[model samples]
Target chain A: MTESVLASWREGPVKQAIVDFVALATTPGPGFVAVADRIATFDNDGTLWVEQPLPPQFDFVFRRWAQEIKQDPSLAEQQPYKAIIARDPAFFAGVATQDPEVVGALLAAFARTWKGTTPEEFDAQVREWLQTVKQPKLGVPYIELVYKPMLELLDLLRAHEFRVFVCSGGGRDFMRVFAEETWGIFKENVIGTAAEYRYADGRIVRAEHALGSLNVGPGKPEHIFAQTGRLPALAGGNADVDIEMLEAARFSVLVSHDDEEREFAYTSGGEASLARAKELGWTVVSMKDDWITVF
Target chain B: MTESVLASWREGPVKQAIVDFVALATTPGPGFVAVADRIATFDNDGTLWVEQPLPPQFDFVFRRWAQEIKQDPSLAEQQPYKAIIARDPAFFAGVATQDPEVVGALLAAFARTWKGTTPEEFDAQVREWLQTVKQPKLGVPYIELVYKPMLELLDLLRAHEFRVFVCSGGGRDFMRVFAEETWGIFKENVIGTAAEYRYADGRIVRAEHALGSLNVGPGKPEHIFAQTGRLPALAGGNADVDIEMLEAARFSVLVSHDDEEREFAYTSGGEASLARAKELGWTVVSMKDDWITVF
Candidate 1:
């Protein structure tokens, strides 16, 4: 027999389940899914990459906020800036848990900071950052940190005629900058929280407001449906906020972070999610146990 | 010497313009657009199909309203229902011209009527209406009323590696019902005004509110950008509401209804569009003089 495409994934129930699901979905049987019906979506942050040091998007934004404070001292009066300056553990805990209120405040500030910028201008900055910004602990560029096993999974899905989409809580435009290059997903296939855009004088610019609500919890499925018009046949997520999207899928994979040596280990945000997965009989993947490699 | 793919189009500057634009776009020079940048969007109502007598969506909605008024009696007190009941000329005129206020109120009612329905339920109704309900004057189902020449244009654009999308003021779900079957465009390629969806019980349902503001004028380009992250390389439209979308495109086609016998010939709604087309030097297609066949 030819080697399995998921080389990084160890031969276990977790990997076997994914292989079997694809088998039933592709073969002509009760579980058979037509090409048009084969949709797979994944959460980006913790599921597909390292999110423990904080989600990459938050890091990307925090760097800019740090710089902005140097020029505008009064800006630290705001909730996000204040929290960042004080290194408040409670605020970081809220962020780690994907607290809706805290994330909403951050997104509001994010929208305001980039307002009036054209997509081309915004794209250039994101691309430049992706190539240069190193993960402090990893000492490598951030884009290099995208999980290898998840990419293999994405490939396996795509090879089976499944259209894969990256549904994230990150800014749509921001993720889109590196999505095509890093994940082989196209710009249109990346759905997330987005700035509401304005078109005037034959030009398009980012508006101050977000396009819709945050892409978390229920918003995942909401944004997914708005884009693809159907829930996924298979979905993968790792944190509490991804619970709703995972619940709505035919098969759910909840990645459990338990390998501190290879990758950071914590159940900080995904505590409830891990419990829910066990209760619902959803597949729980231990990063250290299931995968042969981390990066 | 090959017969043109746009066989329905008469030999004219309008046809020549399209032919020249495609050649330039594909020739790998200053005008050449890479496959990724070759996004083409079209306005669906008067541009892709007949919107007169009334746009097909309004007719579909009006029929449902007529039945509801009989059951509720008080529903007729509402603006859309009351306006439909009285067959108000001003309301009809407002709809024809794509007035934002009239469209917004009508969409508000549209969202409320189908509030808690699942996508499957809403899709069933739209598909049934498309198959069974005949256009009053056309003596055929509304789906059959889609313009053949415009369809040829879609095919031509696709044949040239352009990813064509249908961007309309109608509900996104509604357009998606027949998008692939009728236009050969996928469900995800349809962008339109839509319901805010709710997810619970592992099921997604349409919420009471519209997804965003009315998809007319600036909203068209905004919705298009929200989906694809960039403006169109080529675009086609037929009314005032499409002006912004068309204005943003590198190449724009403004279809003018001037064939009374072959097709309806009133530019009542497109007067401003026609004026803008002239001002912007947009290619204006006169149905009477340009197209050899209307359907």
Candidate 2:
């Protein structure tokens, strides 16, 4: 047999599903999809890279929030700000519980930090953070924490003429900074939540509010439609926030974090997604069994 | 010498400018752009296709408005609807004058017709309109009115590995319907003004309001940065609305409507752009002088 594109993946259901789908898509048969319709999208944070202890974007924002609080002590009393400053375990536990209130509070705080900057300035800030900051556990730049096997999957899809897009809940500009270098995806192919912008003084500057919806949960499919005018043929994600996106695709893959030694093992936030994968007969990839390496 | 990409174009400053810019971008020289950064954006209306008399989108909206008015005669008295229904030449004259109030009124009417429809439904509507409607003077479908020279330029740029995008002031979903077949550009590469969408009942439906800024004037560069995260290396346009987009690019080309024999000729809406083109030493392609063919 010819070598498989997903060489790092073991001989298992996960690898077999991908190989079979690609074969079906590329071969001249009833299931063949045209090259133009071969669009694939992946959830960025947990699916493509590390989103453990904290999402890298949250870490970046936390440092900024801490500095803001230090400069203006009065700001520390704000509910979410106070919780972040104190490292309140209860507040973080709420995040782990996937509490909507806590997540909204966190996003509100994150939005405030980069509200008024131009997109170019925001990208520059993100590039600086990516250069200086390292993931706490991995001790490497956040981009380096990307899963090796998943990267291979991305390449495999691209080899079959699929246009891969990184659809993330993270800031669109933040992901664009490193997407091209780390993922070999074009900046235009990175879709995420964005702040509104207005033209003033011969330049476009970011408005303090979001454009409309966040690129999470149902927003994923909404954005994919708004931006590309087509649903992805293949979609992958790792959490409940990505469930709607996966459902919109013809082939859905969910990554199960069950390998504590190689990666953080968690079944709390992604419980619904994991259950859905099983219920719908979607491909659920066990980190330990499906991949020979984590990063 | 080898055959030139723009063979139909008569040799002049405009043709030379395009040829020089492409050579500089592709060769190993001081201004050689990497393949990844070779982005070329074009304005959709007059720059790529006919916009005289009325933009083809306005024609589509006008028909929709007429249908809306017939169903609800009460709408006929509405300010913009009244103006459109009466076929008031003065009202359209204001559009040529770039009257903000008149343009805003027209857009408000246009939005009401398409809002609440799912993207798939919106695209289907646009596709139907394209099939049935033909430009009054051109006596051809709107898609066929696209400039033959511009089509050649797009193909040439694609051959050089430059990613070309259509940035328009028209509706995003409306353009995606025909961009792929008409221009040899994919739906994802077409960027324009978009309405906000909400996920409901397992499908995304357009919200009643626009997401943010219209993709016109300075909004062109802003939307380009927001969507693609990069400025265009080369840009083209034909009217004042596209001046800022051209200003944002490294190489700018403005198409002047001077071929009254073949295409409608007007220097009114585009006067400011023509003036700026002259002042900035930008390439201004005179339709009568520069091209041997109009369509």
Candidate 3:
């Protein structure tokens, strides 16, 4: 393979489809229709942005929660709030997002903190937070911890007219606040978990709820279809939660978090969803072998 | 005036900003930085796609209604359903999109005709319809009837990296489906009026209720805030309804549909909003004076 093809392999489907699709789309005969259609879906946490111990939004929220408790001190005595105040990682490990009440409350708190903030303000806030907030072990900005290869992949797809969307398991609106500035991605296109809203003083407000399910696994595709009627022609993800989204497309790939030296060698808890991805004809991207850079 | 600026003047505000924003975006040094920071917002109807003599979607609905009426004449005896059966232009004119009952019934009928259809099926149906569908007076494919100068503007904006978005009064999702193919604009960047949704039997269903107010006139700014949370540095629209959106921007312009001989010369029935846009310091685009071509 040429250096371009080698680079293409690392980037995933768009590069691979270019030549063939170009020929088909631009067939010389009359009645030749060129849709030039290229839709690419990305998993937000690990695929587009960073997701180390957990997704970055969760990390942000955890820190925010910790700060809230730091101010009150009494919150440390409550059940879930106590765990949040204590910064007890063990306490968080058992918490299930599927509990509608818990998720709803958290979602509400998140919406209050971020909603109605203009894009400029939000971008500045995201930039400042990413700069100051360091991953505990790595001692670098959280933004610096994003997968570099995936960033390259995003550019590669955009260059080929592939519209990129983040069908994440994260909060839908949270991604909107930062995606544009961090990755040049837009907010309207990022589909994740849905939240309830209310109207107050002639303005719409996202209501805080303590119960909701984390949009993951099956929910990725569900949210994607509900928000954007277009199924991606190409897609990528790091876990099995992304399989449904990938399966909905003509092209699919999974970024194997296997290179400990360059990045994190990790899996979500016990189940190895990446293994199942390979079994489904999805390309397994080995970080060590495939990437020249891994942020 | 420069050749480029003069060319832009004819295209309308939506088109002008694209050219100006793109030029500044690609220019070297501080010029690019200053210009790239300019956010350009576009109206979706006549401003982006073809919506004169009613939106392209209304044509589809009308056609479907006509077909159904031919099959079942008894349907003509109903109220709004009767209007649909008769293909009555007046009923379409009174399209009460905000009323849940009206929207629900229409959306149900629309879903019945469109759902479970593959992307291929949808696109083919649209393309075939486009071949015959024409502006009642203009007598041309709606796609072929797109404003050429506006198209040049879009290309110009993309060249600059100026963040562009479609903030319109039309359906939020429908704009996304054809925007990429029509303007080479990404789907995520488009924001418009929204509809509610429901999940049933492993399939997503469109709810008949309006998700929010029709994003027009004053509501344009509201939608932009809800979707992007950014007051556009630059924005454009074609009618009195677009005044609020254009006026809200730092650099704003209004496209006056005054050139009857070239394009269709007509005005939407409403209070004169373009006057307000002008008083608010928006640049007024004279269709007759500014454009060399009207697609």
User: Each prediction's Cα lDDT score?
Assistant: 0.87, 0.85, 0.63
Across A172-272, the per-residue lDDT of candidate 1 in tens digits comes to: 88988888778887788899988888888878888887766678888999999999888888999999989999998888899999998988889887888
Choose 2 or 3, whichever is better by lDDT.
Answer: 2
**Native A-B contact fraction in model 2:** 0.67
Model 1 chain B worst lDDT window (10 residues): B92-101
| TM-score result, candidate 1 | 0.94
Candidate 1 per-residue lDDT over residues B72-153, each given as its tens digit = 9998888888888898989867764568778777767877678889989888999889989887787998899889999999
Candidate 2 residue spans exceeding 4 A from truth:
A88-112, A199-204, B89-108
Over 4 Å off in model 1, which ranges?
A: A1-4, A92-104, B1-4, B92-104
Candidate 2 residue lDDT tens string, B95-162: 65557888688667756776687777877888899989988887998888989899888988998999
C-alpha RMSD by candidate, in order: 2.2, 2.4, 5.8
Supply candidate 2's per-residue lDDT for B158. Answer: 94
Candidate 2 is scored at a TM of: 0.94
**Residue pairs in candidate 1 whose N, alpha carbon or C atoms collide under 3 angstroms:** none
